[model samples]
Target: MTQINITRVLKGKYTIMIVLIIGIILYNIMNDENLTFTENIIGRMIYTYSLFRNVVSLTNYEEIEKFRSNDCSIYKNLIFGFSNKNELGIIVEHSIGYGENQEWSILDEYESLEIENIMGNRHWIEIDESGELTDGISMDMNRELHKDEVVVNFIVSKKLLENNNKLKQNLIRPVKCSTKKLCSNLYFDESKVKVVYENDNISTINKDDKAESPGIVIYVHGGGFVFGDMNTYEKVLQKHAIQLGKLNKPSIIVYIGYRKSPKWKYPIPLEDVIASISWIHSNAERLGLNPNKLVVLGDSAGGSLATSSIASCLSIKDQSKRRNNNVLSKRFHNYCKWVDHVKFLGLIYPALCQKCVTNSKLKNYKFGFLTLSSLLWFEKQYQSKYIESYFDWRSQPLLAPANILRKFPKTSIVLMKSDILYDEGRLMYETLLKLKVNAKLRIFSGFHGIYGSSWSSGGSNALEFINSEISEIMNQNN
Candidate 1:
């Protein structure tokens, strides 16, 4: 070979070596620096990456169809949806398994929601029993809708929501506080919210311009605060649609997307969540949904957020109780001042208390899908550094004052036996009862991530319980 040929071969070898080294680093080490690098560098190429994942998921759609209801097919018309991927600063395990034994057990240990997400338009990444990821999805084009469902993709102008609330807070500030300084520091974000309902002879379908819905269920999703988006939880929304249809309560189900943490911390996620509620209440009359009847449902970490949101709502609703507690001063933006409208709260295996380490956590946290290691990591990433204390009720709704807990809307706490978060769910239920806040608690067999899945007998039963609880809440005072 000539000298030029030798130089080119050397260059090729160098390139291969660099690629191999990077891959090794990524495979073994997934710290903040590694993930941030991925988010900033590789994530920008999501348009192409998403295209490949979308193709893979399209193939899985055929197999996952039986598990999905017709109305749940969010990717029936797949559009490149990588832009919709919420970049989490750190990735925590929401249970690929608890430990090595749990991992080696069987494929049955995985939730069907794992396989059910095969049709997720932007989020189809499923870690199989082999611990290999073989799927993904992205969004580069406009979100599409299935023929049978009235799926309306809407944007909550979080920036606008924050500014409007700033004005309100400035208006309501106590005389002691300085008028020159704003009462609440501002957090600006843009959130994607989807409104899904059955297509039952609706005349207009202009995204958010109009909709035909009787009542509404506002859903918040969980991914250990590191992952999860509207796409990942489409099946849960579909489950809601199925139950609502069965109960003859046909309502608009709104799924909201908040920014992931470590990249975006604490109050920002909470802010995005409450803003969705305010948006719904403001537009209920226009959307043809009953403003007086609304329910908020959340899973895992989302349950904590949902609880915090309602706690914020209660703080705003009953200010007399806010006198002594300094945390109560951390009011959420005028989140749907129609607090009376939120009829109920549904929490599925929620992480309610940041400080509690119950018997269940001691036993199941090490061997469950939601492992104790992941929970500690999640709290570290998800909690706000700016806050005065880590255990504040902002994230730990279980710690909210007794008076506020007393005023909480009717709530249903659903749990799974042998799950890490079970005891806390029970704790919340018992506390609610102590406070005389109309609360119901149910425990089913199996582990976390089962309530929204259809794989195991336990998952099916848990899902049924959730459906029934939500249905009862929707029907109450109707």
Candidate 2:
């Protein structure tokens, strides 16, 4: 060849060399980066295709779909069948299993075959028929290849599942504390005091000791009125308990753990909380607590409970009953003594909108996303002849805070910008203001339970900010 022709050929060879080098670098980068399952699979397929470019057949979407749907079992046979000309078999174990003694036979898989992922360390070949993967065994999205369909076994904490009878001991529960500054040496009487009484069933207490008091903050946790206990909110209580202790204006917090749904629906839990407050007011002296200082706080469904409890306390009927019934009078006198009873309410993303009138937030959890079984369970709990007639397709106005705004204490509410229950808090606060009930609102940048110190969404400072705000309000009221 002429010298000029030779130079041109050499230039082409050099260009090819550069391309190969660049391709190898890109492959290494993709493998090193953490990727989603789909992305990882796509990347691997691309890499594999590059190795056997000429042997692989390129097809359109329709053809690919046809192959995928047509006798997947027959395709299964093709997967084990010999590789196309120039194609080599890579021993990849499928999440699904092949027979133990049965190795997939594809024309020696062309060149090489080796297992990558297998079922339970068991030997099985992944049959890559066409381009799609078909493992004899089903695999979890996490790539947890199982021998059979059975998943690996695990257990919930026994300490967590137990009745949590000993509140003092079960301090490690989810809602036990909001901060280390909150939880320390917490305990409550394992005794029940009458709150709701066809006869008697409930307990409550309050206290404000200037020393070592986690100033009395009454909390109502949300579990859709079905499942939840004082233990449910142990963490937040513990954190505040410690904070209050540090402040010297310590608090004797009280919680009215009420009967859950199905057995007792609607006003039952509300009555229980109100009655517990009454009992606390009456028994404050015995418990060494201050009946004078109290704040009501609730979250999720419990927000509805908290709002209703305050409404009940403010009711003209409840006040009259206390006046007539000396027993009732004495029990709640300290709590009711105030021209400003129950200084403040801190509603944390309450589920106040029970009507479910197609709010935008519902789109995220439009169906049973929040709790499939729990929602069904709640329906079952309240499904009775009397309740059926009383409750309509829409939730009762009594269940919503907007309806009870006529008489409410000065309230501060914290809401999540992205929470489904955001409007509940907003509407309630707006309603309270409209009704001349003093209210403050804070919209935080996070999801629900932003104030909590656990597997929470975000905004870690929410708990501290609210606590400080509540303390300031209580001091002002005092």
Top-scoring candidate (lDDT): 1
State the TM-score for model 1. Answer: 0.56
C-alpha lDDT values of all predictions: 0.51, 0.43
Error of 1 at 336 (Å): 3.9
Instruction: Give the Å shift of residue 453 in candidate 1.
Output: 1.3
lDDT of 1 by residue, 198-257 (tens): 222322223332223456677787766655655566555555554554354445466766
TM-score each candidate. 0.56, 0.50
Model 2 score (lDDT)? 0.43
- Which residue segments of model 1 deviate by more than 4 Å? 1-213, 320-333, 365-368, 387-391
How far out, in Å, is residue 315 in model 1?
A: 1.1
- Which 10-residue window of candidate 1 scores lowest in summed lDDT? 88-97
lDDT score for residue 188 of model 1: 11
